[model samples]
Target: MKRMIYSMAIPLSIALSANAQDTIPPDKLYGELFVDVQMNRIFPDGKTFVDCTAKRSPAAIVEDYTKIKKAPTADFSLKKFVEDNFDLPLAPSDNYKTDKNADVQTHIKQLWQVLKRNPDKTVAGSTLLPLPNSYIVPGGRFREVYYWDSYFTMLGLEASGETAMIENLVNNFSWLLSQYGHVPNGNRTYYLSRSQPPFFSLMLDLLAKKSGDKVYAEYQRPLQSEYDYWMDKTAPTKHVVKMPNGDVLNRYYDQYETPRQESYREDVELGAKANEAVKKARYRSLRSAAESGWDFSTRWFADGKNISTIETTNFLPVDLNCLLYHLEITLSKSYKATGDLLRANLYTQIAEKRKTAINKYLFNAADGWYYDYNISGKALSNSMTIAGITPFYFALAPKERIEKAAGIVEKKFLKPGGVVTTLKNSGQQWDAPNGWAPLEWMAIKGLEQYGKNDLAKEIAKRWIDLNVKVYKATGKMMEKYNVENIDATAGGGEYPSQDGFGWTNGVLMQLMKEYPTP
Candidate 1:
């Protein structure tokens, strides 16, 4: 029942030796470039400006967003709220002119043609090719605004010398927090009750250092609220809470949407439709907050059996737990940034304790790596990937152990473009051949964090090389790449495995700017 106000610290300048834009104040820096998430938000006719908070609905077959229906203040439905809150308007969701053009897609191809090459500064402090059809609108981008994609896209921005862009990204996300407790997976009718990875804190940390913008502290309260939204859900619950035990819901999932297989039609369609084992788990599974894509997702899935449903079945996923550990530490760091030493220390203690507990309770000594654990605290037997490398970012792994894990990346998970989503190659994307950008950066940074710069640089070179090769071949970039054959096209999940993938574009831009292929 208490509301807390947190002030943001704006550093006069941050030392970013890597890129352009020598110095800029926090307020003047970029966060959100002007976006036209039309169907996403609502605004009344009399008002010249649209309220991002205004809830609305999509119009006839992608009609002009202004033409969409907006709810009055009293009638905001969950659907409207999700759509309006995170909409990305005017984006060319139609990245390819034809199926033949799929391999030729690039972020630029998805934007307004007029703005294609012209550069404009974004709210995140980077220059973006503002597309045409600003107010006029365009064909796609309805779902990108709300998924796991933006995170990796932000990394792309970093690769492309767009530090300022990420700053705006952080700020815009922070602003979203001030307005809404959590950023829904997308601006649509479906994505109301879930979130992707709790990377807001991680992104905030990156933006904080990049912008020397302590404005992150301003976001602390909301950030904490969002965290609480998910973390608190872990509290022991019976009524269909997500957990392997079916008795205890873990901290992530909230509820299920489409029955098990109905959601991941494409992925499962390729494999066996839900088997008895899957059906049992699906009906038994509760879901964590929806992040980017839908269905009881692969986010929680371990060695391919779709562990996302049972709240804690994949209890100690190395990646999920690792990310959680970082979120906690990030909060602790944010606390110190705002000068709350005591509180910061408390959080730090908690984070460290959690790290210790995970290592002690979840790390499979025999397996010599981290894995998901069952209720009895025994590790799940599988080769699934749950982000074993990120712990290096937090100084959690011992040097020897990190090397052991890094070796796994080289031997199994590493893809030419980046690290495959997982080791399974079970056709459940989170498992294989599909190389994602965020994991590329995570692997890169995690290696660097451990002074494994040589290894980091090697992986970076492979990824960047693949990106260049594909760009040269297709004249575009995409949400993911087929690392197995860098020259081949990547298969996408959700509608047609899209291009103009916001997160892909963002990450490429970011990486090109910072960790150039050289």
Candidate 2:
């Protein structure tokens, strides 16, 4: 076998020649028009307006708005003007109707076509950063490819033998990483300020499983680029944090402190009562929490009861660190495959150091679980969410600690339907009663890693059963489920529970394949 080697010095030169630049985020690009439309509630959802495709160029539209707004006519209607100038965002599954009686796997296979998006054409004023490859969106309001969501979605794609689709998705992400400094939360101008969870390495791992080891060499630059973005030495105190003992870890962060363009209205309303300093802090916390993918949860809040009291930037999240650890491990393995012993050793040392830091700061031996460390206060966070199980998923937890943590999960987190996100009923979608596909998948995999197959099986069976029951009742898969009440609908998010859900369908298909019915 020929060992293919990738040079570490090629990315900078390639990026310089690529003719692509980092997208100006929608809030900045659209200027006052963006603020006016969002603040005035021109559309029902703030996201609806931002996602719109402008008929004219963005600059022309903004110019028109500036001239028209200063001296308005009596017959002028904001809604009418918006409708004429832009094509509104559409739900991915809005046109397709489900077959209630079809087999679940069959239904999912059919849904894939409906959820798939092809290479985007360059629209003059669209927020979509055009992708060169076809990709799967998470369905409903999520019309663009998301960073972390696609990894789990690919699990089902792999199960369905959609190898080509998987390769295309991985290539698309690599393109994003190559063109921009990092993969944004989604391929949208609005998402440029922050990224979701770092799952590019895991996606590469999945691709390498189907393709050969050469896949890693092909994507070596992207892997390095993504890692560099997270561990940026320029701002050590931001995304990359140095602990009191000098152990380095990571936290979720956003580049901008302004309200997220997608959720502009909601954020403005929440921060309405605060002073400028307090509002800026709240906005920063909100944006950082968005980067976590948990979006709204008690885990980031100071009071544990209100979004206004969020302190997202003050903690070192266990899950974020665990993902970075996996990235380091993957980089080590990739370098070893290419016979670069020096680089491989460097990554191995980094991974080992990160593993030690995780155990020291995130783990809680007496409490039998892991928790986020409050960086500012210098103590472990009080909130205990399912994120603690992440270390076991990566096999980084010690055997003794794994047993205690598994016990804690079974005793406290487990519910009738499946494991709830958090124990706190904080009226957030990521909190009590809402079982998300990704978290459920994580918990099951982590449990199985430590020889806790019984608990893992139970979780899989319960989650599968709930999925089936809901499908039978509604003829649709949902984004999340209310695990505590098997019959009730999942609620309590900024938006309604979304259907045509990509992750749910993916997890259900994968689990049903593993634990099939007689």
Q: Per-candidate TM vs. native? A: 0.65, 0.95
Q: Which ten residues in a row have the lowest lDDT in candidate 2?
A: 1-10
Q: Write model 1 residue lDDT over 251-304, tens digit each, in one string.
A: 344333333211333223323456666653443343342342323335454434
Task: Give the winner by TM-score.
Answer: 2
Q: Can you tell me which runs of candidate 1 are displaced by over 4 Å?
A: 1-144, 158-168, 178-180, 233-251, 257-314, 492-494, 513-518
The alpha-carbon lDDT assigned to residue 386 of candidate 1 equals 35
Q: Compose the digit string of candidate 2's lDDT tens values, residues 202-254.
A: 88888888877877767777788788878873222269889888899999988
Q: Pick the candidate with the highest lDDT.
A: 2
Estimate the overall C-alpha local distance difference test score of candidate 1.
0.49
